[model samples]
Target: MELIQEVMIMYCTRNVTEDLVWVGGNDRRLSLFEGVYKVPYGVSYNSYLLLDEKTVLLDTVDKAVGGIFFENIEHTLNGRPLDYLIVNHMEPDHCAMIEDLTRRHPETVIVTNAKVAGMIKQFFNFDIDSKLKLVSEGDELSTGKHNLTFIMAPMVHWPEVMVTYDKTDRIPFSADAFGCFGAINGALFADEVDFYRDYFDEARRYYTNIVGKYGAQVQALLKKASAVEISMICPLHGFVWRRDFADYIAAYDKWSRYEPEKQGVVIAYGSIYGNTENAAEILACRLNELGIRTKMFDVSVVPASEIVAATFEYSHVVFASATYNGGIFVKMEDLLHDLAAHNFQNRTVALIENGTWAAMTAKQTAELLGKCKNLNILEQKVTIKSSVKQAQNEDIDALAKTIAGTF
Candidate 1:
């Protein structure tokens, strides 16, 4: 005789508004997000279901959570025919289940822009023209009492990205904007958790690593969004913002302009031996003793993403490295390039170099950092030979004093 084993479900979803429900799901099983950033608390893929006069889904979750997502949708619908499937950002994580959703809801009309329509055709092999309903910026779709206005968000992280404004509810379904990295846990809203204490770091990391390069684009999107009165924000990831969310919007505005959140020093050091790190430690100690906030990391130990995230939040930065073959150390070099590639700029910087023979790291680092935008590199640099010598302690002190003086 054949035996059947009962299937277990692993999913958590919530409701956003009176008629709108959050039918998204989480992926605690995903260790790495985008196969690069480390997601310790995992990540959440958000999608919304609108129980209007006509049923609609804002977006779809990642394929990893598609099963639970579909089940949630099925339960929420309760046999109501899905009328519209709105496509915002066409990233694979958001669009992975596009074909699957269409197959399940055959009567559903796919609503998107012309560029996204092409992308849909590129991503799936279906007769899209028959089900496609193309829209543009300022276009509105009325579903019962709700009127959603589309706002184009080009390269806020993607060219095809767009946000929807629910004028009826004063909610903006922001696509990838104001998004963070972490599963929503059991809570669905930002006010439900101590966001700053528990999730702020991950949010910074997510913004810096993924969307850091396109600050200009983000600024444009923000300017456009300012014209609309946003009461609540529904991003495609992490927590929803319904209450006490002004600070969150302010954060996006500041970050998009490449402004630091607070006045603190982030010291990232690269050392083959312990000498360079020792020098870095001495400087950090002096800064702390001077009543300045400081965060220190070894480039070899901490991943570049974390360091970059910290640097993005702080007003000042310090780089210490031991010369490697007459150049900056490999890890340190990679980290600097990573920061530069992400358009990291607009902060005060100091440097420290250590070498037995050729001490050229500080100059090289300064030159590389100089190529970026509006960075204030200090004239004072600390130089160490083998270790933190008693005489070089004065140099460390001087650098620390200079860094503190800026604040």
Candidate 2:
């Protein structure tokens, strides 16, 4: 059977290869992904169906697109019974349709690891014990032409996670290792779209905010991947990587190592009456004037997650906050804590604090940043009394030059 050749991002069925078809769907109506990150462009729940001597479904989509997903399966299978249902990761977005899919294809055998088998019992009430086919690291499953080898990838954000390698097509069915946060509305492959322009920010945000803390685990996974000869990467979300994807993989290497992709500055500040913001703006202007790339955000307006992601992108971060009752401003405090929680490390930091009487946010914010690892705080801190004073303006100039010189 031939598949549709039209390229679109809607809930449409398409072919991934001669033996495989994409039976996934996108949700534009979804406002916030996981009730946290704002998805103005929405996100995708990807699933693939393989048709060989015995048919196999790689994974299931989020429950939001259950109707479209099942429709795609019915259309792709064309009445052929599903022989195997592979569970790459047990995350809710990728595993929500398991029970329903099994019920529709009652004879489909689930191929997963031992950990995911226990998770199945917790997520659904079906008789998984009878239909479960457990695999371990380096375990291979033959579906006529394609041989899938499973690699254990525990704590790559989840305890029960793994990725599959197809020997026939040289493709890796990565669970969430290379995925992003945006929907696939046009091109399915990263090489087909302007990936760096459209999806790069979301990809950084997805990794830094969602999977940032698991650098060691991701590093371990990358080491395992190096052992195989991969021609393409089909992750559970975002676009597939067929060609010109070395940069993305290299980025994962850097990100997993908690290394910056670029040497620049990202300034995030909290202000009560705009005094701290004023200080931040001055620093940003001076830094850019000195030929240091700068990105500025106000904690009161921009999302903390975005700021956290920015911190991951650049080598330097400037934390400026107006002192509130002898403490760091509420929003700045939260933003700093968020960065620390995401396992932020190996970056230089500069401080700027504004207070009418007792300027203490520079010290307080430093205390919070101290919770992170390998941070280099600059000795040249800037303090403002309610606003940027005449002498304090000179202090800002010195601090900006020191930050710019680090590059």
Candidate 3:
């Protein structure tokens, strides 16, 4: 006699381990992430469900996809009641569905730190104290067969942020430490996709904008993480790192230490007319002629997030802008503010300013870049009067040489 097999349906859910499943969904329809940066490739909200002795759900999804998330949880649980819900980060993108989850599984205990617990109250009017089980650093929560250790990672982008480490699987549920801003379309693990080709830029943008402000905190977390054995990194966003852990860790180390990942030049210019842009193009050509690689971006066109990422990636950065209202161009000023706010450091920067009369952009740009640490502002400031004249070519060449010498 032949037996019939009962096939189970999974709605965008994948298994991380025999007892652990990925119960997260992607937000491809949302135009902006946090109403600030553009996510052209979309983003993912990663949450894992561990079906151990105690069925545990780690983190919730944004309210936009709350329905799909609940469906995923139901399908994965297969009618089993939820025992615990671990809150890694209190950001609404990860905690918007907390009240909904508690309503669905009233018996499930919400686990998090005291600071995050307070944030939960501020964001929502839920009775957190009634169901909250606060865990401190070095605290452990044992589920039937798996044990998770909490590591406090304060100012890792947030004051209440913390990571959960599963001792049995040696996986760290990093809240936002190793996260990126791209949707996981079919491929869930880093090795499953062409990471460098597909998600490297987005990952850099995510890191530089979201967590770049707290490099010291990240360094401290890395030191603490080195003491433990981490084989797999399952962050709250983007792909899971099941292979090449060292490469990713090293990248994070370099990024947190404000070190450039490559030797190249990034030319960012804000031009009202084509004159300023023309000067920028000329400089880029000169840099290329000298065998120095360059990445050029028009500040008015390209997003500031990309420029910030490029500034972090390259060893040299050139800010070329046309004077507007006797000051630096607004878009260029905004980009510089972002770079300084993100604590951009350890790079050689050159200034190129254009003005018909009263050229004050160079001075203003210098003052802005001066706020940053370890920035080597080149002495040769290329000043374009109305347009790039034949006399300025020598100055541009000198500036190019100064920049190339550093490489």
Off by over 4 Å in 2: 1-11
Could you give candidate 3's per-residue lDDT for residues 73-121 as a string of tens digits? Answer: 9999999999999999989899999999998999999999999999999
lDDT of each: 0.90, 0.90, 0.92
Task: Judge candidate 2 at residue 76 and give its lDDT.
Answer: 85
TM-score of 2: 0.96
TM-score of each prediction: 0.95, 0.96, 0.97
Q: What is candidate 2's lDDT per residue for 253-281, written digit by digit as tens?
A: 99999999888999998989888888899
lDDT of 3: 0.92
User: Using lDDT as the measure, what is the rank order of every candidate, best first?
Assistant: 3, 1, 2
Residue 153 error for model 2, in Å? 0.8
Worst 10 residues of 2 by lDDT: 7-16
TM-score of 3: 0.97
